[model samples]
Target: MSAYRGVRIADFTQGVAGPMACMLLGDFEAEIVKVEPPGGDRLKDHPGYSAWNRNKTVVTLDLSVPADLAQAKDLARAADIAVFDHPPGDLEALGLDAASLRDGAPHLIHVWMPPYGTCGRWSRMPPRHSLLAAISGIAFRQGAHGDSPIHLILPIGWYGQAVMAAGAMGAALYERGASGQGQAVTVSGLHGVSEVGGVVMVLDQPRLPRGAPQGASPSYRLYQCGDGEWFFLATLFMPFFRKAIDALGLGAHWEVLVLNPALALDVLEEVFRSQPRRHWLGLLADAGVPCAPVGNRTDWFAGDAVRHAGLRLEFDDPVRGPLAMPGPPARLSATPASVRSLPTAGPLPAWGPPQPRTIGPGASRPLEGVRVLDMGSVIAGALAGAVLANLGAEVIKIESPEGDPFRSDGGPFLTCNRGKRGLGIDLKQPGAKEMFFDLVRQSDVVLDNYRFGVRKRLGVDYEALRQINPRIISCSVNAYGDAGPRAPLPGFDPLLQAEGGMMAAQGGDAEPVLHTIAVNDVATAGVVAFGIISALNARRRTGEGQEVITSLLAQSLTFQLGEVVTWEGRPPAPSGGIDCVGLSPAHRYYECQDGWLAVAAETVAEAEALLTVLGTQADPTDALTAPPEGPLAGRLAATLAGRPRAAALDALEAAGVPCAPCVRGYEAYDDPWLAENDVFVAWRHPRLGEAVGVRSYADFDRTPGGFRHPVPDAGEHTRQVLAEFGLAPERIEALLAAGAVFEPAAARSHLRDGGAALFTQ
Candidate 1:
């Protein structure tokens, strides 16, 4: 929405994460002045630069020059938010750090995003996504089981960082509206790992359920048809999987299929291969199974589905000419976000700070007084609520009487549902709708991931809820956008991954490879969170709330923002081959004698240093100008093949090239670098006992948040919450007796066993 209307920002950042973060705000009508250096951003030529710098005013200044530095400081002091990404201590010398600028403009929201953090063991490392991914176990997570790590072509973590920063900015603004003061916000590239990897990257015993590198499970993986075309079957939930079996005439094999997934894998593979893609897809679609044909980004760009859903944007650029790329991440029904204009070079516009907002007293957290009802199940919808919970909203996750099937999915459930209380009710029962509307009357937001019309049928759609609470916000997540032909189809992460070209891109020239990171699911959570908060910000100003919407389909394009664009004279979008080493020899993973080493040498100087370390005769400046399918890549690989991993990293680091060992996500728990930064959070769960996950990604100087509650058991807080909401004890008991409300036997056992220790660390 135009929730950020009238907001002004001084964007003193470059590269993927920082620029994308600022651009997301600009999408909603925020006025941004991008202050570039005399030579412009180091990534100015990168494909995504055009998309990331849209809807902003661009100006160039040399911070080393006194006159230019003063102009930059003036712009920062005059803005509502000042955002920058620099190595630790680099900005203080220029008098642009938070303390320096905030001294003169106490109302400016200062944000700094270092590669690691403002202060940490790896803070000074070059802000390279490859190095961050390697050191933080992202590379290892992308690798196939029993395979060497594959360097990622998609900078998913950086995108995660961008969305997290955008949300944190909204949180800060919401808080400032109350206190009439601004504060410093920090969201590091490393913090992005927490946003995307929180589910699988754990430091606990009994690791989360994992799938083969190809897919999550037999029913939820990619398959090749007889015509050689591939499609992803995404029946992650059992009901759909069972439907798929019955539709396939395999009902007789259902017992074995349910009990022995390994055997079922073989049967399903043969069954899918027996027919052409269209034939199987037709049957599956008729049976209401979720699946999509594997496609590439180039084709996806031309798809009718995207155009129909309005997820594609067309803009004319002075340099790139006519360009087409992805639209904003979320859709706001009332105050919709739009692409106003492309960034153009200009001097800073004359500006002054506006009158400060004077609202009611602020709380300890940005969303402290906000209340939310999370009716979403599984990852995308549930994780959105968890994000709001971390932002200090009181979130209650509503489940059916039998509870969310995903609750048994272990770490994934804990990851998405943490910091929220649980309530269980059967809406079909006599008094359930009355009880639900009571909670809706008091809540500010309601979230769900049901298919397009399911909410309307369930009597919880936006129209139904708005009638009950005029100020209520409704957030809906789905596989596709709200009004597309596919909007009514059931879908999941891999379905979008297949249709949006992620699988083809990641797989390169080989068969489609499904990323195990749950890229679409994780990213949708953050985006949905931002949309909900953006609506909240709008409500604060206009005294009304509206619909907030996002889908995995939108995020699929967003995750590959750089590659999802096309324009005249634009270079080919970079795609890694099956090797997954990298886009070029200078910036990729190299196998060493002991382990893998990742090197990031994109610039001429860094490329020269890398060549020198490898004793290569290749011209440094032109080394990466061509694809790495030449002798240069071969030589670089040959040189590192003889050396040990640690030695290669040492040589590269000493030569001023960024590098890190490809450490497994699980092994990162023992790394002293991350430990020194205190990046992990440990909490207890009623069912799973002690567990550790990545901490909250964004940091607010005046209002920090961390683990405040454990994962809730089904209906765990139903009685307490109902009583607190003014329901009498007898009424609650009567509802429970009438089967309108429920607490499972396991939850009752937990209470009897003194589960007070569940929320403790």
Candidate 2:
């Protein structure tokens, strides 16, 4: 059964993010009708377009012509969904905006991707992914003071935003299937960047530790062994730290290890350098520390984990020949995601007919009948369950008696937890155990992001839960994998960034930089949500639920693959920081009269052509710093320095050079591009009046769903949620009196309780 078979998407997206969302839909057997301009999208000739546009038919449509405009509208009217990334009003000028189609094809799903959305302070300014990265503070976290913010080796902000869009679309489609209406979905690159790295901004954590650089404590960072091979230690918590100490025979220095990271690093460094990475990794693993080799892309591919997990994929394209890339970062037994070569594989990967669904009565969302017990904390796991909630799952958030620390953290919490129900309980109270087990018995799944073994410690591990309800799907999220050297240790998002080589890639060897965006955690949230959906799909067939485990370490590796390709026998590589250290002149940033801009030209001829547009002639005999660096680079740089950004952009684009102006739009509130895309909205924040917000990244043809309401105050739903779980009012009152369960705020007085209330709201 294909996950998205029979779905038809009319895509008018350009560049990486929007195209990638529709591409994933294609991977799942959705029909993609990609409408390109005369010259094609900005990346039509680029390899990425191929990577993302598989299983699709392409058509050229010049919207300026009345005939082509009619044809494009016809395609949109016929599609179950239409996706575009153009800024505000671009489609409206051509009479193809939301209002135009709403009457003719009310069932059409209209989705728009923008840099900044339409109504926010920054809505009108156009920004590329790099600028979003900088505004999100991810760059600031990537380097130390006096260092200019380093851009990531990959378009992480865009990709992360796209992944979120894919999930949003999937949910929308599912909703449409249940209902019979369609509506708009909007996702913004800047907000996506903000969500991924939001842990720092939301938690009030500094970019780095007070005075120290961004590296972790002694046993949880990169260490080079005698062979110069490097491996990472991810023991962020004390238990894992103890294991590292015991494994390294440094138990005698427990007191200093307890308080002094500097002293401990010195001691551990000497011991680590004395042995090879393999030996230390083995010993650390045996000692129960979570550790993995500091490998590049090649090493990662060669590792046993990816192949076993089906993370790597290969497709033989007739036009492009053999093309290999990482497969979907998830796996499902019954309905797995597939990849294919364009014009080669027939319909990409063919799929079995979808199994008939068992929809609940009066349902208007994809996950209408599903129930989830979200015991998630902080960012990753909570967000994962929140995805389910927004999809119409009955999610009851189980917070501690003290409340989710996040309820006080502000927007990150409110936005992430907007649609879910909340209940506060202290499992430590003996009386609460049965109540939790009761909730578990009714739930289809249980999710958490506790430290590696906290579920077991709390007697809520999969095995124990299975004893109560055999079909319960158990999912656990952590900083590191479950069975490694640092498994028992605790970790934070940026700490994982530092250990997993992202910071190193951005900041180089000086001091470990951190990407505050929690890129790993954000991507991992999507992965977790996908994994849960996959598990649910599998369980439907097997009638047996299984445990799903994921880690920040694994996700960060997937994100870092663009910068580092590792192989067996490869020596360790240092991060080449953001100053064009490893990129070609064409791929590097250049100064312009107004600001900065970036370009990419893989071949010397391409570079030469670009230089010509910049008014410089290429000199074959000139010395070059990067390979194939034509003589015109230095001269082109000097010329670009004097030209205003718009003029330079016009020339380069006319010459077909791959480039974009790096404008700072984080503070701007007016850009026609964003307004046309419908990415921004003036959301009403109860306390802040009308505040700008980004919408979810999906549109549905049937049921256009959104957050039921703004984030609830912690314990606001305690009484109501308990009543739904079959508890009598007296029982709820008794539990409240006993202090086993908590409800700090009054339940909304007027609304009928349960997920169904969202329709009325």
TM-score of 1: 0.94
What RMSD, rounded to one decimal, does every model reach? 3.8, 8.2
Tens-digit per-residue lDDT, 486-563, candidate 2: 566666565456445565565554433444345676678777776676566456546777787777766765454333
lDDT by residue (tens digit), candidate 1, 393-434: 899988886666566535666778888998888889999999
Q: Provide TM-scores for the models.
A: 0.94, 0.71
Residue 412 CA displacement from its true place in model 2, Å: 8.2
| Strongest candidate by TM-score | 1
> By lDDT, who's the top model here?
1
